[model samples]
Target: MKIAVVAANGKVARKVITEAIKRGHDVTAFGRHKENNTDASKYVIKDILDLKKEDLEGFDVVVDAFGTWASEAMHLHTVTSQHLADLLEHTNTRLLIVGGAGSLYTNKEHTETVASGPDFPHDWLPVANAMADSLNALRKRNDVHWTYLSPAANFVADGEATGKYAFAGEELTLNKNNESTISYADYASAMLDVIENGQHDKERISVYAD
Candidate 1:
C-alpha cells in the first residue's frame, strides 16, 4: 500500500510510519517540521492546511494524524478534517484519522462520553472536545471513505507494543484492572490493521489494552 501520513513529526504518526514500513508499504510523510530521519520513502514539509489534493495523489490511504492543543483547537481540528475529506472525496484514497478517546462513552449505558466525564483533564478539554466534534463531522460525510480510530483513555508515548489489542464500540474499553490504556506502538498496529483490512469504514473505532 502507498500511504501518506499527515503530521509526520508527531509521536503516534512516527510510530505509524515505522509500523507501516515494517509491513513493506510505501509511505510519504508530511509535517510542519522536517526531521533528519524517517523510513518514509518521501517527505513533504508543509502545514496540513496548505496541502493540496494533488500533493496527496496516488496514495492508497491518507492518515490524518494532524492534531493541535493551541487556542485554535476547534478550528484546527474541524478545518483539517474537512479539508482532508474534501481532498479525498470521490477518490480511491481512504482517510484514516488518529483521534482522541474523549468521544468514547465512559460507561456501559453509553450515555456519557469520556469528555463529558468529571475526570477528563481540564487543560486538555479544548482539544479533546474539538476532536469529538471532528468525529461528528466525519460521521456526517457521505462522499469520503473515512475511519476515525480513537485510542485508549490513557494513551501515552511510553509503553511496549505487546503486539496485542482489543476493540470496543463508542465506549471506553478497559482491561481486567479496569485501566483504559494502549501503547503507542499497538495503537499504530491497530490503525494499520484498519488501513490494510478496511474493516471499519466511515466510523469511529476504539482500541485499548486487553
Candidate 2:
C-alpha cells in the first residue's frame, strides 16, 4: 500500500516511516524542515496549513502526526484539526492520527486521564488536552475513515522496541501492575497495523504494555 506520513521529521513519525518502508510499503514523507534526513526521497517540504490537494493525491493512507503547542492551546488544536479534516474531506483519503493519551478513560464514568492528573507535567496539559479535542472533532465526521491512537499513559523518550502490546477501545488498558506504558517503536507498529488493516475506524483507541 502507498502511504503518506505528515510531519515525517518528528521522532515518532520517523519510526513509522522507517517501519513502513521496511515492511515494503511505498511511502511519501512530508515535513516542514528541509534539513531533516528522511529515508524517503519523495519528500514534500510544506506547511500543513498550506498543503494542497494535489500534494496528497494517490495515497492509500495519510498519517497526521503534525502538531504545535507554542500558541494558545485551543487555537493550536483547532488549526491542526482543521487542516487534517480538510485533507480527509478534499483528498478523500483515510487518516491515522498520532493522538494523545488524555482521551482514554479507565472506564466510561471517568472524567480525567492519567496525563491530566497532578503527576503529569503542567506544561504538557495544553497539548494533551488539545489532542483529545482534536480526536473528538474527528469522531464526529462520518465521511472519513479515521483512527486516533493514544499511547500508554507513561510513554517516555526511549524503551525497548519489543513490539508487544495490548489494545483497548474507549476504555484505557492497564497491565498486571496497573500501569499504562509503551515504547515509541511499538506505538509506531500499532499505528501501521491500523493503517493496513483499517481497525477501529472512526474511533479512538489506546496501546499499552501488558
Candidate 3:
C-alpha cells in the first residue's frame, strides 16, 4: 500500500516509516526537517499546515503522526488535526490519527488519566484539551473514514514491540499490575495493523499493554 506519513521526523513517525518500508510498502514521508540518511532522501520536507489538497492526492492511507513536543503548545495539534481533516475531505483515502491519552477514560463519565490526574502536567493541559476537542469534532464527520489511536497514559520510550496488546473503545485498559503503558514501537505496529487490516473505521480506539 502507498502510505503518506505526516510528521515523519517524529520518533514514532520515524519508526513507523521504517517498518512500513521494511514491510515493502511505498511510503511518502512528509515533515519539516530532512535528516541525514538513505531514508531521509525519501522524505518530502513540508509543513502539514501549508499542505494543499493536491499535495495529498495519491496516497492509500494517511497517518497523522505529527505531534507537538512536551514543551510546545497544544495549538499545533489542533491546527494539524483541522488541516488533516480538510485534506481528507478532498481524498477517498483513510486517515489514521495519533491522538493523546487525555481523551481516553477509565470510566463512563470521567477522564481520570490525563484530564484530571494529579501527575498530569499543568502546562500541557491546553494541548491535551485541544486534541480531545479535535477528536470529538472528527467523530461527527461521516464523509471520511478516520480512526483515532490513543496510546496509554504512561507511554514511555522503553520496551520493545511485543505485538501483544489490548484494545478498548473510549474506556482505558489496564495491565496485570493495574497500570497503563505501551511502547512507541508496539504502538506503531498496532497502527499499521489497523491500516493493513482495514479495521475500526470512523472510530477512536485506545491501545495499552496487557
- Candidates in order have lDDT scores of 0.89, 0.80, 0.81
Tens-digit per-residue lDDT, 1-210, candidate 2: 899888889888888898899888999988888865677767988877778777877888998887676745466565665676776784447888888887677556877666656777888878777887787788778877777888988776588789778888777788898888898888988888888776787788888877
Candidate 2's C-alpha runs over 4 A off are 71-74, 90-92
Which candidate comes out best when scored by TM-score? 1
Candidate RMSDs in order: 1.4, 1.9, 2.2
Which window of ten consecutive residues has the lowest lDDT sum in model 2?
71-80
Return the lDDT, model 1, position 187. 97
Judge candidate 2 against the unseen true structure and give its global Cα lDDT, from 0 to 1.
0.80
Best by lDDT: 1
| Backbone clash tally (model 2) | 0
Q: How big is the positional error of residue 141 in model 1, measured in Å on the Cα after superposition? A: 0.2
Model 1: lDDT equals: 0.89
Q: Whose TM-score is higher: candidate 2's or candidate 3's? A: 2
Better of 1 and 2 by TM-score: 1
User: Which window of 10 residues has the lowest lDDT sum in candidate 1?
Assistant: 32-41
